[model samples]
Target: MAQSPGDGPKRVAIIGSSGGNLHSHGGDDPARLLADIARQLDAAGIELAAVQFVAAQSSMDHASDDTAATLWTLEPAGPAPTAQGSLSEVNETAGEHDERLAQSLRSGEIDGLILVSADPSGTNGKAVAAAAEVRAPASGTGGTSLATAQALGVDLVAGSGTTGTTSATRAVSYVSGLARRWGLKYRPVIGSGPSTVAEGSPWRRISIRGIMVGSIPAFIAMALVLAISKIPGLDFLSPVFDTLMEGLPIVVAAVAARRVSGLGEVGLVAGAVAGILSAQGGILGGLVGGVLAGVLASYLLTWTLAHRFPATTANIVTGGLAGLLGGLVVHFALAPLTSAIGDGVKTGIEALVEFNPLLAGAVAGLVMWPAIIGGVYHAVILPLVLVEMGEKGHSFFGAIDMVGLVMVSLGITLANVVLPRSSGERALAASGAAVNFGFGTFVEAAYPFLFADKRVFAGALLSAAAGGALVGWTGSEATAYLPAFVPPFIATNKLGMALAMVVACACAFAVTALANLHHRRKQRA
Candidate 1:
């Protein structure tokens, strides 16, 4: 038996033999063969309590009618087991044997169980069923099985007895790996017994929804700021809007941290720290600061709770202290690091525009589709675009935005209407078209079509590049920094905007519809 480093003792049982006659240089002795297998497992860091051998009835030869034959038995010379007369007899006893195995596992007498088979078909139908039944709900531990049969629950390693020692080695390795996964999934919390908390850590259980919810406030703020900017006499409120816009990253960061940590107090602290950092380093700073603060706060909170602090005050005191310390650290230490980053981004964008505005516009258009899909367009990229917009009346990014939100979406919608597709898809296309044309928000409806097919994405990219190039070549500008759905015509003259839109829509429609038609034809052929 071998003890794994950093892990407590684990009792394991192996059922089934390598099969065939036990062979070694010394000669054939089943006990020696079993000992050899156990030694191999020990060398591979597997601790084994016992090995049970199940020999097929067909493989055995009866000596005489009066002699009691030993067909199956435990290793290290245990009492000879009664031989089953037939396959049906073995199957009949499987249920009772499986129940006993399950009881041993539940009672913690056996920490792990391995079912080895000399037959590649996995012992027999009856035996496999018996192994599977051990993982049933009635056996306790929910449906968590000791074996990986059915691709559900914990995975058990299986190997063929025919493959010899190599297969046996693999089985040992698999058992070791399974034990490691089990420990990770069921590790006890610090300062708490194993009986207190269920399997899996809090951090491991966090969902994507938590992260998305954090970004909601920032998204809403973006829409509201742009919408308000369109109102007359609101020009005086530009400073206020700019402040909120700059602080949006902090809000996003805080919310995200809160969601991930599942601690409202910690989230608020993180938001405050991120907001302070963002004020100095801009949007990038806010994002980094929020993550750092949230992580630090979470650890502090966990420590406080684990120490048996009064439940009522633990969250507030620990969270507050962590936030205060984290905010101070970020403001004094990390804030200066991000200032250089912000400055470098502004400088880089300016240099790109100066070098080749047309090329820059085209590239921005090409990349915007992926950015939109990744949520970066709204979170990080769009804010940078706004920075450029504030300096100049418009940005090359705006052209890409215009093409992506309006023309590309419209083209895709048209393709859906013209091509053969499901009624559900057509309806979605119609809805997207309506939203883009009516409300000027293509994001809601456009994403589905863009992501539905690779051809659609390619069409959108080409269309965006064309529109972006046109905008750049014409030196078209937009006065208002609105969402992508708003046409460039609002800021630039109608003629250039219209020409770009026409080119974009045409390219997108032709590419998408033709690709779809070609696919359909190929399928038919």
Candidate 2:
């Protein structure tokens, strides 16, 4: 369902099937209301695939007159709809308009469905009553939608009650349940469909692993992950994890256990082993132990899922990424590179912890971002590379943390694969990639302003590389895990590394933004 582990994306759609006569909160027509709603949702992180207009009348006059400005991220190929409001008037009957709705549903090309004022009966209370034929189909229609959605195995719902607030609650509840059941952590943000309800969760879409992506496959994968986690054996702290690992040799080539999603248990083992290794022998343990654990887990899990869900371009990509990047290779690799790229920084960090603890701690706090970037890379990207690399090291699943080397190498071969198309997107994507590489986790810190109008994804990388470069130059080192989005683990030479990191991040941000602005100006001309 998702792309490779290192890859992150958000995609969504919005539509209103309410009768054309429905009033906007501010009294604008449905089309105008829709434009405003889509804009608002975009701000909240739900990138709309399209803002469709279904109203009193359907014609080119309404479609051509769409004045809503659209949003274009640094990533998307082209401009996105802002006021892309169109008109779809009453059709002769419900069955006649089935294709229109079906086509609308397909346009989003997403995993879940979001309905605005889903109750057709409530939407055109007066109109349908006036037209006996239209009214005849209303009540029965809602019942049919419920049955069809269930039979099709599609989880569909509206999001408002007062303005359909009940639908909103229902949608959130259903979506959350789906995530829990499947262990698939993905939240497809649907804004203003049932009205502009602010989301309680900080992330619009998040997986069982707590990562976010709006893609359909990603969501399904999340569901699968959640389901797998519940198995008696997959939970790391539980004895089941040990039992499963011990049985790797036997079950390695046989069938999988059923309690958890076939693969979640294996993922848990890999992740848990990686954690244990990191704590045991520092970076070396993390890389080597993690790879061994991951390889073992994959063998067992693969045996289990062999015929059921099987591996895919995406599944292998995400898990393999986690194996290689999150634990060992990068952890150890960075330590060695200190002399060349990050030099005196390490000594400075060490000294701070040893001598000037407070100041050093503050510096560590500052460098915390790189630590997070670096850490997230360990947790995600490495595992993916482990599977994709599929070379001699294929058996060494745990050490796949070494596979993170591949993501960087991809720059030479597949750099353009997930790279931002525009300057803004590049800044965001780059920052995210860099942050993942340097600090260890959470792409959120760099995602904003990435698609914020101009293409800024490239800027993120410029920012990240700068931070990483400084770490290389200063030779700053983190002890435990690179402090994630929160902070770094204690270390010496903290202040120097932190200062270097700051300068690098600043440089990256400046360079990327400048380049993007220049590009945009040229394009406008």
Candidate 3:
């Protein structure tokens, strides 16, 4: 029965279908699915006002403007109202024309909307905005759709047929519960809230500066560790340095998270959990664990504080519980999962290196450029190289990897110097050159140029690959962790190292120069 608009029960509309065939199941047909959804709504004492079926399409962007067909609309009469046409045309004919579908939502006819799509993109920002405009609560089932809904400040609910029969039933119940709670004002529980800081805002810039400041301690520790390892008879301090390296990740994570969250204690605990996870799983694991821990701690603390408990007792209890839960989960579950993944990666690298060191080195070098840019090489791959170095007393892979990075940085610096766009650019390039040659950390300087010009990046990548391959082919190794660009080759073949560096520098310089020249000519034209 159609419930009156002013009735206590909420009025809702279901849009889209599951976009999957039921395979002779009773719920296979679109009409059946809509009926089932309506029944669910009825059970919850919510009135199902309408069902809008949008034609299935691989890409939502390609869906026809007239694609939506109103299959059913509730009425007090004998038969439900039905309409067949392009959704755009139907809306246009109604004399309430608006360019975006969201404009229709401003009518405030529906109290709640359920968007059921197989994919998230099926329900675009327009639909979400419309829901928001009317202050109508909305929910979605699919991951993409749900994510979109969340990002756009809509409530989320599970959908049917995706997981299993049991899950489908649970999803229905979940939505019903939400329907029961419709009287309450809806606010997104997850994601960045309204009044988000803009990307270029001074606050965001300050956060970036904070991150850089926080990183300095870890950087100094690493450099100290590397320098100490190179000195003869300083091997006794290796464990201390290794401990520093391991602990520094936690400190950095804590400081960064604290700065971002403005929750110092919770951020520290989260960072500690992440550091431990990282030690177990590597960089990627640590990052995941840290983020999870931070969010968990923040939420728990916020929830606890909201109840007006004694401040000291509440903090201790909430903070302790949050840390315990986060630490346990990461240590017991996430650690093992990340460890397994790391093992698989290590196995792959070993197999490839055994098959052909030169090919493996070249491939690794090629891959490293992207990995470095993506910030994965340091977190995941570098640890494996370091482990191999420890086991074998030296690592050909390490030598090639380090040398390739150094050479590429040098190449980028030289490019800027040779083809200065401005006096400021030239000065910046010179500074980068100093860092690359003196400190062996060129990432800060090189990234700007690499991202600015595709041709220059390509040149650097190719050069690095060639250098890596040559180093591997020659079986070069390094006994201690030393800057690839520095003197005193340690246990490595100095001659081979020198040759590889020369080749890498020459290739990088030549390619970058040509690309710069081309760019200049294009500018002139």
Candidate 4:
């Protein structure tokens, strides 16, 4: 039950095993173990909250020691940081050790847990085993101890190693991996500590990366709508998918709010309010509203806390004020501005296509892949495409994307699978291609080869440019992002779109296969 600062890093509890057949299993050492764990967590932008050592002295009596006297700050733990001095060598036999652990899990304070137990029969091991049987609340089942961790959304990682340092290191890797996947970063505590350094330009993380993250659910919903339309009975569920698509703004706001403001309840409330009020403006509006709300709420909360306001009262004030101010700003000012921008973008593209369709198409196709690489396709280009499709029932940009990016990527993947240097590579390439086809929202299937050689990527881009030129010439348009096989069925210029895709695929395939062959020959020489 240690206290953390208002804007502190994530708090993780460390559980360790001791006593009971300790020698038969590797002996538990306090020195260097907690230090390594702390250091690892710090590197990942997390902080150690508390450490508890459990000893299963007998079936009836268990001994537990709470050794985390020092409040582990955000500083990196030195190499020799030890728990020996502060850790009570208390062999106090208690039957309530499990209850204490369970209480910690039930409390909303701990953000994550690390369990270090080599033996399955040990106290720590037993707790871990019991957690496996407990289902999250979403599944409608629950258990005690570690089960509480699962239900409460506390991330848990079990370490794997004979020694304490090795096991802790392994566990830290999992925590780091999860943080990376979620785009979580450790930042300095606001207000009191050293001033937090500013992040990179808004174009990189805020506009591009944040919008991309927020757009994922919408993209998935779009894919589902396309996939379900082809299914027989599932067409009835189209409304459900449509509802999800309609709430795209809310989804974007939620993600944006949580990312900008910590996972505070206030930020979510503000984001939702802003999103609901700004729904007419689409994803662009949501992005602006959510970021505004989150920034306002975060700073308000900090100021309230600094003034020693009650936590609950501070949170209420923050959410209320942020929602009111942010919603007003978006509704009266930013929403109309964003809508105008989206309209202007669509009109410009349409005019370009009208003037010289071939050149326009070629240029669009050539830039599409680079934009994806530069992280601008989703943030800047997608909102325009979505707006166009919503108003006109189809999008020319979508047509270009399908053939130039998706189909070309597919072609590169097929080439690798067909002319792979090894069996493993062939298998990998095939699976990657299958995944790309199944998802139809990304071109990651081509990433391996794209990064492996510049020539192959250049060839793919050129082929896409040529295909795009044809699409422009034919004036193809699509209502959705579809797989290679499905696009022709839904596109405005069916035969033309098909032809463009085929040409793009064929050119990409030949270029990639030849590049692979050249590389192989050079290796032999």
- Full-model lDDT, candidate 3: 0.54
Candidate 4 global TM-score: 0.60
Descending-TM-score candidate ranking: 4, 1, 3, 2
TM-score for each prediction?
A: 0.51, 0.23, 0.47, 0.60
Q: Would you list the C-alpha lDDT of every candidate in the order shown?
A: 0.51, 0.32, 0.54, 0.59
Q: Give lDDT tens digits, candidate 3, residues 286-399.
A: 444555555555555445434433223334544455545655666777877765664565566567766897887687677767887787766655555544432333455556
> Which candidate achieves the best TM-score against the true structure?
4
**Which residue window of length 10 is worst by lDDT in model 2?**
252-261
Query: Any runs in candidate 3 off by more than 4 Å, and if so which?
Result: 1-224, 245-262, 273-289, 332-334, 367-401, 415-428, 442-458, 474-499, 510-525
Q: Per-residue alpha-carbon lDDT of model 1 for 199-258, expressed as tens digits?
A: 124354233344434454454455455546656876666676677666655665576455
lDDT of 2: 0.32
Q: Report the number of clashing residue pairs per model.
A: 1, 123, 3, 0
Better of 1 and 4 by TM-score: 4
* Candidate 4 residue lDDT tens string, 184-211: 6632232111221243111222454655
The model with the greatest lDDT is 4
